[model samples]
Target: MDEKVVRYKKNSNDIHVLPPSPYTEVPKPNVRREKLSVENEETIQTKKKLEKTKKNFLFDPRRKTFLGRSSLNWARLAAFYTVFYFCLGMFFVILLYVFALILDREVPTYYNKDSTMAVRTTATVVGMGFRPQPMVDDSLIRVSNDLYEQKRIASSLRLYRDVYLIQKTDAKAEPCTELDPASELVPGTACSFSWFDIVSTQDHPCSDNNMYGFKHEEPCVLVKLNKVYGWTPTKGPLPIHIQGLRNIHNNKSIAKPDVYITCDGTNPSDRDAQTEMVYYSLEKPSGSSKYGVIPNYYFPYRNARDHVQPFVLVQFKNLPLHRLISITCRAWSPGIEHETRGMRGMVAFQLYRSQVAEKLIKDDN
Candidate 1:
C-alpha cells in the first residue's frame, strides 16, 4: 500500500481514509423525464399567455361569437321563443271569436224578471211616467206663471219635446185602422205614429204657449207610457167605474177600440173640487167604439225605428191650489197588470200650487 496508515475500525472502514476508484461507471442522462417536464412547463406558460389576451365582449374575434354565445346558438333561442308566443296569442284569438258567435244582436240575452208583470217569462212592462218634475224622485208638480218655477218646467218640457220626440229612423211604417189593428205590426215594417196630431186641438189648448195652462189656473201635465218590447194589451171590456169615453154622447163619433186611461183623486174632498179635464192626443172615435181612446194600433210596440211613443197631455181646468193634492192615473187593459205596490201600469203625482194659478179657485167661489 502506498503510504497506507493502519487504522483500528469501529465498525467499518472510514470514508475519509478510503481510496478512489479507478474507473467509475458513468450514469445515463434521463432524457425522457427531462423532456416531459419541459413540455409541461411550456403548456403552463402558453395557457397563462392566452389568459392575458383581452377577448372582446362586443365581438369575440377568436370564436366568432357575441357576448360569449355563438350566433347560431342565439338564433336557435330566438326562434324557440318566437313560435311559442305566436301560438299563445292565436289560441286566445280563436277563443274570443267563438264567444262572439253565441251572442244575439237585436234580442237581449236577459230581461227584467219583476213579478209585477204577471208574466214571468217575458220582459217587464213599462210603467206610466210624467215630466216637468223639479227633480226626478219628487212625486209632486209645482209650477206657477208668477213664480220662477215655471221657467224650469218649461225648459224641461221643451227639452223633452226635442229629445224623446225625435224620429230615430226613417223605416217605412204602415198606416193602420181599428179594423186592421194587426196592420200596425208587419213582420218587417214599422208603424206610423201621428206626431203632429199630438197637440193639434181646436186651438193649441195644452201647448206651451198658454204657459201649459199654469197661467189660467189650469196646470197641464204630460203623461207618457214606458216602452216595452213587443208588448200588446189584450182586447177586453172596461171596468164599471172607469167611464172612459162612455159618458160622452156624440153620434158623429166613429167606433175605435182603445186602451183607456183615467185619473182621479183618492180623497173625497179632492173629487168634489169640480175639476174639469181636457185630454190631448185622444184618438178620434173611428169605429164601432163609443169613446175617445188610445187606439189599439199604438200597442204591441216592436221598438221599430222611426217610432215615437205617443204621450197624453192632460189640462186640469180647476185643480185645487194651496194644498197638497193627490192624483192617480191608470191604464186599463186586459194584458196590463195593476200593482199598487209596484207602481206598475199606473202613476201617482201630488199637485201643490199657491201662487198665480190659485186665483182660478177664488174666482169660482
Candidate 2:
C-alpha cells in the first residue's frame, strides 16, 4: 500500500509528499530536525558589532569617505589642524623675537647676584671662590700634609699662577692707569705681572718653589676679590687693629688701599691656635705683615677681553694638627656691604691637616 511522508524544503517549512516506492531507494535523513539556530543573542550581537566596526574602518568609495570620515569632514579637520599649528608656530617665533629685542649682546640682562636669583642661596653681595677644589659644591680645605696630596696641590697652584703669567693681552690695550676720560676699558689696559709676582717671588712661602707652603704642613690659601662690574672702590687707610693682627707696622704716611683682605680664626681658641698668619699679594708685597690689598686703580672692571683679577695669597703656619680651624676671610672697606647671616663681602671655610712623613716637597719634575 502507498504511505504518506514528510519532506523538507530549504526555504519553506515542511511538506507532506509521497515516499519512494520499492522501485527506487531513498537515503534516511541523518539530521533529526533543521538547525533553527545554534548561535545565541550574544553571538549575533557580537557579529553585528564586528561588522559595524569593519564597515566604519573600510574606505567607502561610493561615499568618497576616508578613514571613516566624509571627504568634506576630512578637509575641515585637516584645515583646522594646519591653521592651529601654524598659529602656534608663529606665536612661538614672535615670542623669541621679543626676547631677542630685550636682550643685549654686550651686557647681560640680569647680572651679578640677580643673575642667580631663584637659582642659588648665595647672598646678593659678591663672594669669593676657592680653587683646587677636589669636591663640587663644597668649600672645605682638607689639605693633608701627605706628600702625594701636596704635590698634586702644588701642581694645581702652578697651573693657576701660570694661567696669568702665560696670558697674552690684546695688542690694542694700554695700561689701565693711562685710560682717558669716558674709558669703557674695552680690551682693558694691561697690568705688568712682574709688579704683581707672588707666584714667582723668591724664597716666599707663598711662592710655587716652596709648594705654596703646603709641603711643611703650612698650607697656603689664595683669596681673590669677587668681581663686580663698574665697581669703583673708595681708597682708605687700613685699620690699626687689623694691621696689628697682621703683625705689620704701617707707616701712616703712605696711603692704604680700600680693600683690606684679612683672614682670622672664628673662635677664641682657634684664633689663639692660629699662631702664624701671613699675607702676600701679586700687586703689593708689603713684607707678609701688611694685609693684602686690591688697589683702587683696579676698579671699574668693564669685562675686558684681557682683564686679570687681583688675588691675595695667604700662608698659614703653626696651626694645630688633626683639628678643624674655622677661618673667615673678608674684604673690608668703608662702604662695602657685609651681611651677618650670609658671608657677604667675605668667604668662610674650615682648614684641616693630617700628620705626614718628612719628605722634600721640591722635585725636579
Global lDDT of each candidate: 0.65, 0.66
Worst 10 residues of 2 by lDDT: 176-185
For every model shown, what is its TM-score relative to the native structure?
Answer: 0.60, 0.63
Q: How close is candidate 1 to the true structure, as a TM-score?
A: 0.60
| The candidate that achieves the highest lDDT relative to the unseen native structure | 2
lDDT of 2 at 85: 100
Which window of 10 residues has the lowest lDDT sum in candidate 1?
284-293
Give a tens-digit lDDT track for model 1, residues 92-208: 999989878987554445544544453742435658887657677888877554545665676776677667664545556666666566444666456566434566542465566
Residue pairs with clashing backbones, model 2? 196-282
Using TM-score, give the best candidate's number: 2
Clash totals in order: 6, 1
lDDT of 2 by residue, 1-365 (tens): 45556677889877768665676555566453434344466689899999877776787666767777997898899999999999999999999999999886656667655676325544335567555455567767767656688888778767766674344644334454424421444444544433245555557776666777887778778887776765555444555655676665764533434567888888887787776777777445644655677665666566655556777777788778778888888886654656648667787778888765454434412
In candidate 2, position 317 carries an lDDT of 81
Full-model lDDT, candidate 1 = 0.65
